[model samples]
Target: MSTVEACEAAQTCWFSCRAAALGGQTWTDGPLHWIREGAEQNLMFPTRIPADAVQSAVEEARETGVQIIGAWLGTEVDASALAAAGFERGWAPSWMAAPVADVGVSDDPRVELQEESNDYSDEYADYAEMLKLTRVRPQHTWYAAAYVEPGKAASRKLAGPRFAGRAWSHLTGETAGVFDMNVWPRFQRRGIGSGLLRAVVAAAAQAGARDAVLNATTEGRLLYETCGFRQIGAGITWWLHLEA
Candidate 1:
């Protein structure tokens, strides 16, 4: 195994948990990301961020000629800073899923969660899949990103090379967030959810993550609970269409 920690850092998919696989265009400033560009809308997704450091990100983007349609901040950040920079949220008020390490994972059998094997069989291909659950509707390109990020699974050289998905462990720091975990509907109820969850928990422990976080779905919440994972908070991510 390449080690889950190595995989997550190589990918920038920390807290997102592959939540929104939008084919978002991205620019990087060290670890900070400007996801989705070249449209009436672009997003500011900051990780390892300090509240006041956000506007500096906006200022940096301006130097590169990228027009920021809007920005998305986890509740821990101050949106007022973005307003000071001349942008306003175009959608409903937003919130974030809080990180909770104090909680534990559930050990239930209604589901078996495991790491995604990049194996694509017609049988597995037809499984019912739930990547991420969100309250906001997204722009077309964002939707495109979701369907594509899954293919990155093919990049792995695991035994079940046909599978495609993402996993993370927060060793030393925060773990790699589990983005989209699902069974092809044809493969559902076979403990696949639980299997994947177990794999992630093990991966996190190995990676030395302090804890893991995910923006779970209603159907998936039970799976997470069974794995000893508890909910700490919820988030609302927004997108604004601009005249690109």
Candidate 2:
């Protein structure tokens, strides 16, 4: 697949995985459009929509009872169409990817990465706590069994009691997409985040994935870049607040 196509496919898989884990829903309104209803009562346009069809998608998303619309800008997607439709562009993240061969695994002794089982009980609780720390109010149930680094006992209250860093990857054939990576504020810059990231990428590679992709926040762009991921495209989310 072309880099652009890979990037789009990676994002599609990432959003779908999140929706499944969180008890949300996903559907496509045709091949060019993919929508996700996140657990937080937010709508996600994870793929590109034709410029002429943007307004219709927004209208349809409103019927799902979500208060926020998160639309990602793909190649050839017109940003002005979104603005014209009452969405405000925010949090322009970078879509990045790397060949599995380029990712380096870190053997950090201070941190241990654990992949949760399918049950996801422990991982979900840890993720909930992380969301709480960030003040995110999720309205629907969400769960994922992914990579996590158990925190030290003494740091339980500040970091999650069971995890200091969390991340997950979804494999779509030969391509893998990484999602929801975060390090507790108390544990930031201690190398825990990078270690967990490397571990997850390596895990995907072991699962027969040749390429790895992720959408990175501004603060995270450098970290992924240092780990050999290059920017393939832009993932811009336009937020539209619903009227009460």
Q: Could you give candidate 1's per-residue lDDT for residues 173-220 as a string of tens digits?
A: 444345445655644565556555555555454445545555566667
Quote model 2's TM-score: 0.72
Off by over 4 Å in 1: 1-33, 36-71, 75-174, 241-244
lDDT of each: 0.42, 0.63
Q: Give me the displacement of residue 227 in model 2, in angstroms.
A: 1.5
lDDT for model 2, on a 0 to 1 scale? Answer: 0.63
lDDT accuracy of residue 184 in candidate 2: 72
Of candidate 2, the 10-residue stretch with the lowest lDDT total is 133-142
User: Tens-digit lDDT track for model 2 on 29-80?
Assistant: 5534455544233334434445556666667667766667676666455567
Query: Candidate 2 regions off by >4 Å?
Result: 30-32, 38-53, 109-162
**Cα-based lDDT at residue 6, candidate 2:** 75
On a 0 to 100 scale, what is the lDDT of residue 204 in model 2? Answer: 67
